[model samples]
Target: MPLWLPVGMVAGVAGWFWLPGEQAWEGLLLSMAALALAGFAFGRGGRAGRSVAIFALSVAIGCGLIWWKAERAGAPVLARDGIANLTARIERVEPLPARQAVRVTLLPLSCSDEGRSAGVCDAALAPQHSRLRRSAVGVIRINIPDENAVPGLAPGAVIALRARLVPPPSAAVPGAYDYSAVAWFSGIPATGKALDPVKLITPAPTGGPAEWLADARIGLTAHIMTELPPGQAGVAAALVTGDMGGVTQDDNDAFRRSGLAHLLSVSGLHLTAAVGATMFLALRLLALWPRLALRAPLLLIAAGCGAVMGIAYTLLTGAEVPTVRSLIAALVVLAGVALGREAMTLRLVAAGALVCVLFWPESVAGPSFQLSFAAILSIVALHELQWTRRTFEKREEPWLRRLLRELAALLLTGLVVEAALAPIAIFHFHRAGLYGAAANIVAIPLTTFVIMPAEALALIADCVGLGAPFWWVTGRALALLLWIAHSVGSLPGAVTFVPTMSRAAFALIAVGGLWLALWRTRARLLGLLPIAAGAAMTLATHPADIFITGDGRHLAVRGLDGRVALLRERTGDYMRDTLSEISGREGDDAIALDDLPGAVCGPDSCTATLIRDNRVWHLLATRSAYRIDRAAMEPACAAADIVASDRRLPDWCRPRWLKADPNLLAKTGGLAIRLVDPGVTSVAELQAAHPWAMVATDHDDRPLPQNDPNFARRAWAARDPWRDDRPADAGGMQR
Candidate 1:
């Protein structure tokens, strides 16, 4: 309950996230020593000294814990890279939302380099080679192209597959999502694609708790599908189970835009409702038995029952990060009831957060953890204020007056939570739900009073063989909820895209928010200084001049007119969406290169010119545009200040001019370039300024050359050099 607990854990998470990967072990040892010294000082020092020592101890402990977790979750180093024949057991199978592929987590039982002497290959894998001899080689994610081909695949199923094994990827751009760090913390060593059909050799063990739960979830989802329309069923299933695969992309987008997306996830709201409803029903039933009720402490009994139900539901929903967070909170509340202590205070929330950080340190980096804790802490702080108490003091009036008070309370709570979470939402998702308060006003009451209650009843009925009617009714409520979401989402400017802010700015804002939420004194007003600073930083930041995908296939640049111009008409959805979000652009209407104000698109290439600081710079997308003759290639290379192509160019290409090809792209990953007075700066250079710079390099230092002889031969063999539609060249620009 001490503020130090959460603060320390946060410091530790920050250390882990930002510290150099190679020095993690060293940092761990140093932190432990510092923690010991601080603890000693805290126990022996005077009052003021004790406070300082406790703060130091907390930070040290945080750093130690983070390093400890990082060490435990280190990625596996395969005995051999490239194609490998692996025998493994499926630990989990999830269908990516709105995607055709199925992502499966596999525990490798054995792996051997392809074409090697099968019996002589190394059976020992990096993650499982420790003294404990655990067989898990860390979980590896494999994307199976055809979901139907692995329709019967479930957890515990053993299969053999040939896959191109590779280490997890790093952040594609600086400040972008770090896939490698996420995977590493989750104990995922590598990711790959199944080269052929997964040959299932064994089925899942029957009657196990995990297997039973999986089967139950699948069956419930299937039943929902049968009883309700596709969209309604998907929403219903999402509420009941954590499976979001059934929800259509459009519906998902609508919910997100309308600020109703939280309802779809199994988070605090759902857990709280389920537990509260269960306890309420249990208490009513207990009261019917007068003699039993007289002897037993009803509150404690109800708390016990609620705790059990919360745990059961969390497990049923696969105990994802948010659910686990909710479960921890429920248990804390139950414990408080058993001990006759007031719950739902800041201390209880801090306790829940401390537990989550200890067990799931990686979650600290996720948006859900930040937003959930912020909202809860803000609500508690708001409730503790004198003004809020005064508003509720005169509550013993008429029913209509009570109803009005409750409505006002709900509105206030929603507003506070939205306000608390807005910065985090913008920082993580780059969008603010403009109508979130209005949407919550209509949607929260309906969901809490009708939809969730109906869902709980439907779940109970389904267990007792009277579920179809309840499910049908539940679907109707869900349909209406969706209607509300759609209506809100359809409003003009329902979602406002914001540019990504620097880590320093986000950290400043977070610290300011926490200071405001944690303190009750008038001094809490001081928190506004850092908040204002962060806001100013955000306003002063500028969008990148050029954005390139990791694959070196897509490119976009900010034209002189301050509008984004795409190099190609067709681009991946992820890239397009990311660009739109970061550039504060609506929809996908960013002008194509040919349509830009000062750009020219030829058969084989597109060229644009931007003048800044009395300098005229030319940008050319020459690759894969059309077949270009030698003479044309030389002129294009000589003329342009930046050339982005995917093909090999002659050595005569200007060395001072930036040339982006697949090789440099492979090394640098994705790029976000800004045009400075003299030249350009890149995300990679900015990243190198941070201590965590090597985390990405640690994944793969020597990527295969972009123009590997054997690879190029195979790659070009299928294409015609003279094809008119083909771009002249395409590759990453040199750093």
Candidate 2:
């Protein structure tokens, strides 16, 4: 019934995949046709029927659009297993400061056979020359260990390298981030590490507008880094070029904890600052000449200039989702100005959201999109309410009073935004910045009033070779800002870890928040029901007792005393820290085998036991713990109630014993096991119960079997041929 129906449609289409199964295009089409027919039939009725018709039509259109987009962005043809000589043109490059690596996304130009000698980049032997010729335009991500690899690498540069290209990995554990899905939508077919050094065959030439813009950004970032201190330079570069590679991990963590992480991203705030500053300067200069100001519609002209500046900034920053959303909103306002109409904030926001969803549908699932839109909607709703109330009480206020009112409004806006985004932040990131409101109160004004304007001036000055002084001043300001972040972040209780919430609970909370924000009546109080229910559901959920990595190399189980016992000595710090936080473990100190109760360690294996509900659950980390001999492994497996290892166990290991070896791990992705009296239930098993589990497969979307009969036999024989002494009829047991 409203123009925002398209936005709802977009949401429906995006969320369709959340239902647990592969959606059939035929069924979707039939349902849509039925809905359209029903809508048409209902349109003959009164206003109420028309409203129902509109809702049905919206759902139909949304489902159709989602299905169409999925069909268009189909899975790419992946490389075969093993190393291949790849000749590709670099499409994008990002530096990983933490990994000391350069991640390059490339478009494959050619591929050599797996066994071909590494350094071959002949155009004649390209994809066209071989059967590996691929017609689909897909991107491949390659991570080169050398940091220097990306120094001169720009988009459009042709290069060659040998690498073992694998499909993007699925979640390491259930409920974790699904990077494979991200890759699917992003059109990245494969990801791998460079086995040989990346050889640049041809340097990128300044050919097109996009290339020129990228080169300019790269050059400007380098100049800024050269002109400022490392930390200050990093912030400046991010503000200017959206290149955050130089930002150190320590500073990143500090900013995030201090609730200033939004400042690092080039979003609505940055765009508004640049465009508003440009418009202000343009109008000021135009007013100096009465003839020109009078002849031209000054506001319109200024708005046009602002629009142009916003577009330029968007292009310069790669037109990311947040930037695009902001740009669309600004354009809507500018359009209203051009048409001599007052821009309604709600309508403009809705229009911008519709445009973003139409173009970048996947963005609906992203935190940036959700958080950005939610905060803006909340602020707009609050502002509208305040304006309405103020309209009734008309009293002229002094300048000092007006200034104080504005400051209070600013503080209120920050508080509203933080409150609105809290649930989303917790759901996605599992952490809430405790002092986000306080941090925003201090940081927003400094960024909006001081830093951004200075940065804009510096950019203009840089063009005329007079940027050094301005950059120096900007750097000093940034340093002070960083100091604030550090100080605030170091304060006690800066951030609190929130447990993960179920998708259903999060959806309920989101729906409730939207209802409260959008409706302007006492009926809005009804939103409290769903919100309260979501909170209750989250509190009722329990943490996993045992978790295992996708590779089955590491396992962490909660002991009876509520302490987490890490089975392996060497586990990734990231995984360990994440699990520790989930288990409510304090500090980052590595928990040793000796420190864990009921943990018995042998030369190369360890067994940990957990007693729960009058039942004992034994976990065995076999040769994978340290590659113990079969003699050592047999005792650990034979005695254990549940076993996890990289290698498969002997046939004598029967069905009664729960086995989590490499084969099972490969199929499950990662596992979170809950020990019960009768048996154990895993995250994988619960996920598999849903029909969508069959559709959501490995990186290539190939359905992996839960149990492979030959898996263990092949795995055991592969390790040591002479050690395959099991009976011929012995078969593998499913978990």
Candidate 3:
């Protein structure tokens, strides 16, 4: 490992982490840092100037490729002062909040002299099959007059709409971003549903060569599905057309548990198989032509196969992000072969990663991109070390030894890659498969050997009507694989939730594991440092003393050590699932907003106190129906410690859980966060009154406003007041 490499990687890591946020100058700074580091590494290695120039050029080319792609995907085109209107064909139809709207790809249309956009053409029409009346002009929530509007409306119909000419999508979510505004710069036209009924605007494309090919794939997949056993049909569909519809959640869970879920999408595995199969068959046939064989390079032939198959798979998956990423990665490797640089090494793999980074910077954060590169890096390192070893170099091995070595290598690589992802998996997902390695052993082989190939074969056979027997073979193989996946996934200890992981833990799992896998000699032993760092972090986490929901539904308290967690409710009924996920406590042990009224549970007991401005009702017991929860929520001022409503109905859910509450609850989220034990104040009550005013206690209590955890930590870290006593705001600051 050269100094420049690691330094460059760290620089790359910084860029990768922050780029998603699109903090403009951060990218520039990281890139410059990487450039400097690479320079230092080159100087240390004493590399020539020409090599450095080539590296720079490669990076430029990569960035150029990505920018080109960004421009092509219907990126928005910017215009000057005036409003413009155009009539374009409906390129896509989407189901928005109220109506069936089509995204019309503008054709040559005109703008208004009044500076307002011209009206759209061919608004919604009463379908011969649809009599439903709809408006034609302004944006209205109405269904499209087509029966086939569910899966999607046709792409090439003509529709004219008069809309406010927006530039592009500047933001993703409505409030957070106007992605529409951003699309303006990218050249994407912003158009909405038409008010007038859409007429038979344009002829839909059908029966053309491209259409026929697409239809053939669809028709073949459907035909194959008819012959499979009922239970196996969905898996076969997923493997064949890349339609994951047939795959049940159970099937997905099984595949995920087995670490082979990536196979469901027609990605790297599919392309590799298609390309490899084609090359083998082509080479075998071409070998018979003695004269041309020597002149026609195998590289060219293989590259062709890779391109054709990669394109085929991409189209089949509708060019989805993961599929596209894999396609691009595969092409890089294939391109390397064509360029006579077929050697597999870390630099080449990094080059591939750089290509991805340059093209779709967004993919730098995607899980597929992360896992793909991790595996590739580990494999390349191990392979290089193997070739470089004294005894292993140019040495013959016994067949048994070769077989064992291959198996060991495969297992070791898989484990290394999986381990490398552990910290992220635990931090983001909080779940890990305990039996994943075992499940992968049976599932990966079965899927690669029996499922995908058989499904593809069945599709091919169906096209020629030699379907029944071929379909039968596919059905049997798919059934076996599906069965194996489900059975393994259902194993008792298949999945376990990892409570949490910190930064140190993540570094350990990713960098340390990679170190152990490829580091040479005793120096490799140092990798354990990261692993130990992670383990220590996990063990020392000292649970969160207080838990607050982003939605302000419920809050819980663990022990003094922040262990033995309890929530206000089992379900995040008041808000999003973030609370349930964050707490690592689920099922019946949930606490509700009102349960604690105003109390904090410590290592000892609980209390029931109230803050200001909100009404609090005490529950002598627990019951179930809070049907009016959404419409008639408890109203608490920004100063109230807790606004609670206790009912006396039977606990329909987790009856036993209601009986076992540590009994304290706090409504988290919102301005409900308060300064240290506002004696009896809830996070909300204190805010509404002095909403604009901030606390001046500490970095946290400086009190402009604070959310949970941060409020607690920062406050705790602050210098305490001279005394722990504050004048009365409510009954007791329940503790």
Name the best candidate (by TM-score). Answer: 1
Tens digits of per-residue lDDT for model 2 on 536-630?
89888776677776777767776655566776666667677666655545326447554687776654566665665555556676544444455
Q: How far is candidate 2 from the true structure (C-alpha RMSD, Å)?
A: 7.1
- The runs of at least 3 residues in candidate 1 whose Cα sits more than 4 Å from the true structure, single-residue gaps closed, are 19-46, 77-86, 95-101, 111-136, 145-147, 161-167, 193-196, 463-465, 559-563, 623-627, 648-650, 655-657, 676-735
Clash pairs, candidate 2, are 20-692, 21-692
Cα shift from native, residue 240, model 2 (Å):
1.0
Q: lDDT of each structure?
A: 0.71, 0.69, 0.46
Q: Each candidate's TM vs. the true structure?
A: 0.86, 0.85, 0.62
lDDT of 3 by residue, 1-735 (tens): 331243243334433333322243245444554764676566665665434534443443444333334334332222212233334454433322112232334443333443232222223111111211332222211224333233312444444333344323221101111233223223343333333444444554776655445555555555545677645776666665666645665677677765667667776666677766776777788778887788889657867876787788777655666677677767777787778885466656666665556556545434667666666676666666754344344347898887776566667656755666555566555556565555566666677766666666766776787767766777777777776677766776565555456545665666676677555677877888887888788766533323433222334443322122333334433222333334444323445434443443322123333222232211112123334332112211112222322332222212101111212221211222222343222323222211011112112211222223344344334533332222233222221
Q: Per-residue lDDT for 620 in model 1?
A: 74
- Which candidate achieves the best lDDT against the true structure? 1
Candidate 3 weakest ten by summed lDDT: 689-698
1 or 3, greater by lDDT: 1
RMSD, every candidate, angstroms: 7.4, 7.1, 11.7
| Candidate 1 lDDT over residue span 285-356, tens digit each | 998999989999988899899999999989888889899899999889889877899888889888988888
